[model samples]
Target chain A: MAAATESFTDQAIEVAGLKVRVMQGGRGSPVVVLHHSTGGPGWIPLFERLSAQHTVVAPDMPGYGQSERPEWAREPRDLAILMNAAIDRLGLTGVTLVGLGFGGFVAAEMATMNPSRLKALVLVGAPGLQPEEGEIADQMMVDYEDYVKAGFRDEAAYTAVFGETAAQDIKTLWDFSREMTARLTWKPYMFNRRLAPLLKEVRTPTLIVWGEKDAVVPPACGRQYKRALPNARLEVVAGAGHLVELEEADRVAKLIAAHAAQA
Target chain B: MFIGYFTERPYQDPSSGYFGATGRDLTDLGMSNASYDPRLGAELYNRYLDEKVYAEEMGFDGLMLNEHHSTPFCMGGVMNVEAAILARITKKAKIVLLGNVLPIWDDPLWLAEELAEIDMISRGRLVTGWVRGTGRESVAHNAQPPFNWERFQEAHDFVVAAWTRPGPFRWEGEHYNYRYVNPWSRPYQQPHPPIWIPGVMSRNTVAWAAKHRYPYVMLATELEPTRQSYQYYDDQAKENGYESGTQNRGYLFKVHVDETEELAEAAARKYIQGPSNPFLEGNQGNVRPFIQNLPGLTSRTNLLPTVQSFALAASRGRLKEHEAATGKKAEAATASADKQDAADFLGTFTDQINKMSIITGTPKTVIPKVRHVLEYLRPGSIFFWDGDGAMTHEDSMRSLRLMGEEVIPAVREMGKSLDLSSPFEVDPRTNQPVA
Candidate 1:
């Protein structure tokens, strides 16, 4: 894998009258990244690696990160609509949509709504489908630090990404992001009951990825996503947790690159 | 002065293993009703109702009731039901609901109708109040936390409109919408019953209450901070073009009176013995920070002084320390010490008394403490929080008798000297000295 040395620039774009903070870089095909419930993790190693081959455009979902909050938006589907409008404003075509965790739910909704606009759909440790055996871990049950740590497989992995303790500003951002998540996804938790049926309608090529030890959303959710989408494949990354993209950025980026190339 | 009586109406089942040395130290949100006995619930509810009746006989001007959900700390989850009962059961004492959790109600029109009926049944003796409920209420009722304040404001408006306006009015709101808001029952009180607001923190609530000229009741907050909170209310009232007075302020605190100081102290110590509630100081169990301070429930930037104090105490691990101490005390008392001593270790009783958080003594000592509170805060209305935690029927009766016989008369004289007049006496609307 090439070194993740690609630099990205932050841009504020207006979508549906809401200011969306978008981080874009690199060249060639467009890969729009949707962030987790705790908002965007900035231009991380995964985005950098992806940007090396493709134009990686990561926008903080409305009400997350630097994006303007829409008080009227009350569900993942609402965010998905806003994101689709954002994609249209960015003038992107044949896009590879990559969603992480809560972002995955939004991505799936967007795909179900407009499958023809995307060349590929990638869901990483997402939680839009109700697991048949286990349940999605409730983020509101613990403190912000504990919830973030739960995303990683170990303390080392957590420290590597978020440091020993997050700064006060970062903690504040996490809290703000969680409030948005609570506003959008408090009921039925992170999953939409109608999503499973809607997923069966989407004909877009999809790649469902899960960590082997993903504790936040069960690995079985990956299999469910695979079964729901007609043209989808599942990949499990070993020794990773919910945040498989961050923990194994090189490997996941390689898989995405390979998948996007085929699409 | 409007003297009222209040209690958490705790579900004190000693067999539930939630009370005592050998019990599971359960937190407020963590408590499950799996061990709840309907038989005990029935008895406790009736007993509490009986006590309220006795309170009316004991000459309390009003009976204050509050609502909390999914917890044993307060059995009045649907406190309106108690208010409705009190309206019919008691003749003179105002049925004060302070208050219904506004944001939790999906339909405020229904709440309006309920209150209207209560007012009519009580011959217009109703003091309706509203609250922006805690995270527990939001979680229990599945109400959106981010829209709590909005929903509360909207709900209050809707209920008031429903009560005062003509029938068949179309209502469309951000949080609620109704095609027809006409209820057959209107409030017996002209222009509707007086609205009051009770709060511990949340500066926004205090300011809002002041703007509306509703009596802002400080619920057992520290004396100094309570004074400061009242000052904030006064400042807000001045900004809104009114000079606020004692009629616009109220205070509720734990005050237990008995024949002797020792007996009063023993019964008062039961305040921290039973199931833990985050609102109650010196609780045995720890509140989950995430659950207690749910995102968007209350803005962090808009907090009162006591919230910072609570945060500081939480950061210092005071709750954990209290739990550990209580656990050890329970273990040590297993062989010899009585049940009272075992539970007495739950909190520093002396500290609470010294801090004036909990006042306990015979009428003479307790009356002086009450006078001190009146002099310090000068609230027009006062509610003595009694018969809570694990205090028995006899213990509650003794306190009520002592309060009626001695403490209340002394407090009334003190109220006169302090120039305190309740909202009922002085119209909150016109800021008149007397209505």
Candidate 2:
């Protein structure tokens, strides 16, 4: 079956000098869901859950989803600034930042770039911090379905893309992911050696999550992340895959809540 | 867990992450000092053991290990031997040898003996995997490369022969020779630890697995292609050619979980897309030997163009020889082919290299996605690939612990009629099965 992911509501907002589309939901302490290349509109369920208590805002990065691609922010750090501006434009003061995939890179930047601005940071299935050699070898691919099929704990991500579903979510995820290729493919994924050291500068209390069976970024790489962030915590979702938070929503929510409460 | 999942080429220096020193590739030949000194390899193996032990201590049900050579990605170039050392490491967790490259390794028999020894050592916690390997890998060591699929079939038999035989064994074969082919330390598990073979172009492998009722692990080359392999196995079983349910088929791929899609995308950017390796796209030519395996295999396929380019990376002094040997007719034919096959899908051999699965998100969002795969790939067990660069140690732990505590439970609750009894049937662990 053709695997698919459901998308989320799309809203565009101009932040700083650039205009970006955001798929936002919920209301309360703001928690931003930064999507990877698969792009959002494929709103994750966790946001829905968090929306009950916290304002869960997911923005399709500049190149993906509802967000307009900005010419200025080419690197992740640049993307982080754009994210901060989006937060500011929405009038979000102290926000809990959570990023997945490439979004995690943004979260990492957010945490250290301006520690005071972000209340807490959560990096889910993030890559590129500790250059752990020869473990994680999941090849990033061409289409959205490949994202899930390549090895998501939620096989539905892949099947949903092909099967009959809420066209809205699938379309959003598809469109956003397609838009992201402009930047993600601007430079192929996974090989930049410069950013690893920058991660050390990130001082925000962070939580990194990974799929134990994550083929894309091996768990070992996740473990290396533990060493990079001084006030960071790591969790390997067992059985659940690359999308640990999606696979194990309750636990992820609990961790998010716990970390947020404590941090 | 089948065996080991290696990065393309890893850094073996002590400074590198993933606890290095053992990662050096001895066979690489290109390095001023290639091949981790077997003793140093042993030391790094100790680190591996330490890591394996930690895997068990981390509430994991199994310890994962594998082999690789000439590259730092995976050290167990020879998994059989690695298994022997692992046998003494831990008793609580299952031992998985994601695989041994049977086609390249000269002796699958010795591999079997080592497998038994390790199985006995683990007191039955052993799982074996076989693979034809990516095309580039086969050409590195084995005499027959690209078209060696036929030879792999033969080598597979000898290995299995050594494993299944009840007593002393003697075999005469085109590739291997052995007189005393018996396990002194028979495996603790009945019928030897489970066997798992995951890869592309393994129709014959699947048929063999079915005949023996062994579970097969399938991380299909691609999502769509996976269906074809699934059908092949199903048809084989329908014909009563192989075991059906009990003969587990564990599928694998990438997964990213997060509370929201946006969060996932963010993580994907850093962990997956942020670093963006510039080397993977286009004619990255990672495989030349595999192409050289068959002068003909190189011709018609889109991969040959890149193969023509990558053969040099081997660093073997003779690549120039191959380049020199390119006759005028071949060049002329290639030039003529370029014109004729203008629209042809070549040049960018690594196109399939990027943008595959990259699951990033929260468990709730990820569970259903996993269930979807269970129904599709139908793997008895599962494996995950972590992005290198180590997102952050603390963050990673939090994520992993959450994965174990949260994700597994949710997925199990979704229970589709899957057979957990099959050898390949097990829960996902850290690149290893949690038994």
Candidate 3:
């Protein structure tokens, strides 16, 4: 990620069709934060910092946090399509999409298909792009709570997930997950087997960061990403697995902050 | 030394019927509706074999074959056996068993020995493709849990050592162990056969392939991504400062050609509804640890991007469903009475999907199209999927024949006349400079 100005938190918006349990904080330019479907109160760390500088609009990304059930945004490409709808409805432009986990896939998709509206993108441990066979099958074994409990850096994030998230975030994430599952498994499990082609079209300055310990979507994914995307860079954080932002919340968030501050 | 690619599909046409026709059958069926017939599959396999023979005779650098389950799209089942068959059939062309599920099969020694036997049978004409099985495949094959790439990675290492280091050795790992790891049958090839890693657009796998300078044979990637991939591998090769892209190999766009583009397009369109659809559909994916784990037909980056773009387009309704319940335009029907048009959105989804899978045209036109893909992407070869779906024995045969006689000859002539030789001169027909 390029250099940026210092700031805190960003704005929030009520995206239509997306299940929203709650919303908060606004300031400066708008940058949407999409969290991976691994589930939790969302990537609030990135928002906690960016919200101060820009209007950090972070949604649980239907089936993620306090967000409402999405009709059916199946794969990474689907997530990008739905996000495009929300972005259009919210009338947000020059949006710098900062995504973590599967959300990184969506952000990359947005950058791929509709780069004009995007200011930049930050993807962390994104799946589907480098879709391979038998990746971290055990992690998929972990349910939302297990993921959340085992995922977060601090108890505060855990509390934020349970309290601020919709229907204690469960009802929404579950229902949204149901839709996501239908959308996902409708075929086999591929979300657009050829999403890599879009990387070249991606004009947005993309920052791909991964935790070294992030076994979910490892550092290798970041390297392939660096080669594929025209305007992209790879940053690897040590001692972080799939949950880098959570494990190294301060560091990952600060990384986002640095990218966000850049012109 | 040699790579063999076949477009054999494991499906029977309406004209024939049977299941598990060959040694490999599509087990672990996902949808109840997608059951397969083995007898018909054997018939199709024979037809595809004819094409492989034609490819070898046509003076192609190599002929390829692979595995697939349930559907004939391709998932190798006992590729070693298939390689043996190719070795028997073609005394000339390089016989490449595009792959075997290295991780899925519990024993690497068995895989190694089987490959060695095939190399002996082919008289030093086998290029091996190795990689981790997809999540679904792991579950289907009951492959020792999916996430353990390390185990498979270890197996790969063990297999290499078993081949490279000649000794009665003790091998122990989380996955497999052996008392006398060395094989009874050393491969006919001197340094064992060349290893080609078929990447599922996977970042790590691609990097590893690039880092090692293994000939990276890509299947099903689009024209643009092909360029990016070549650029990527080339950049890696250049950055790592390698003198040869030959050793850093590539392949582009699985296709089958006929006398005319119309004939080829017709054949492609036929499979578009069959293997192409299911292959793409099978690749769509789930977040389930099981599903995300597998790299299906989409292992090739070139093929994945097209699907991704189309996926984005479909989600946006940019490529609207072809028809409604009554089989009329969806939007127009919505404007009228009754909501059947709206109700049939899901069914219409299949139609929308067909738009992206098939790329049909005439031989002249397709020659340029193939060139466009080739010149732009510059893959070492093109593994034309000549037989797929219920591609009739005659049509599939026709595609192979035409591709060899008409397509290959014509493309080679065009290359010479135009001086449009590829950067990597592995393509033998043209007088291109080999890097």
How high a TM-score does candidate 2 get?
0.45
- Score chain A of model 1 by TM-score against the reference chain A: 0.97
Error of 1 at A107 (Å): 0.8
Every candidate's chain B TM-score: 0.91, 0.66, 0.74
- Tell me, what's the RMSD of every candidate? 6.1, 27.3, 18.6
User: Which of the two, 2 or 3, has more lDDT?
Assistant: 3
DockQ of predicted candidate 3: 0.04
Candidate 3 residue-wise lDDT, B1-435, digit = tens: 122346644454443222213323233233332444566557655665676777687666677766654333453455566678888888787776656766677778887888888888889888787766554456556553322355557877887888878788898776587887768888887767877777544545666666666667666644455555666666765666564444355563546556665566666655544433233433221223224323222222222223332332222232232221112333533245225323322222234324222344556555666666545554554566556654666776666566666677776665555444332344222223554
* TM-scores for candidates 1 onward, in order: 0.93, 0.45, 0.53
**Tens digit of lDDT per residue, candidate 3, span A26-120?**
57777777766644444355556666667777665654555665543445566677678778867788887878776776777777777888887
Pitting candidate 1 against candidate 2, the one with the higher TM-score is 1
Q: Which stretches of candidate 2 lie over 4 Å from their true place?
A: A1-263, B1-64, B81-86, B135-137, B240-243, B256-356, B387-396, B416-435
Provide DockQ values for all models, in the order shown: 0.72, 0.01, 0.04
Worst 10 residues of 1 chain B by lDDT: B322-331
- Ten-residue stretch with the least lDDT total in model 2 chain B: B295-304
Candidate with the larger DockQ of 1 and 3? 1
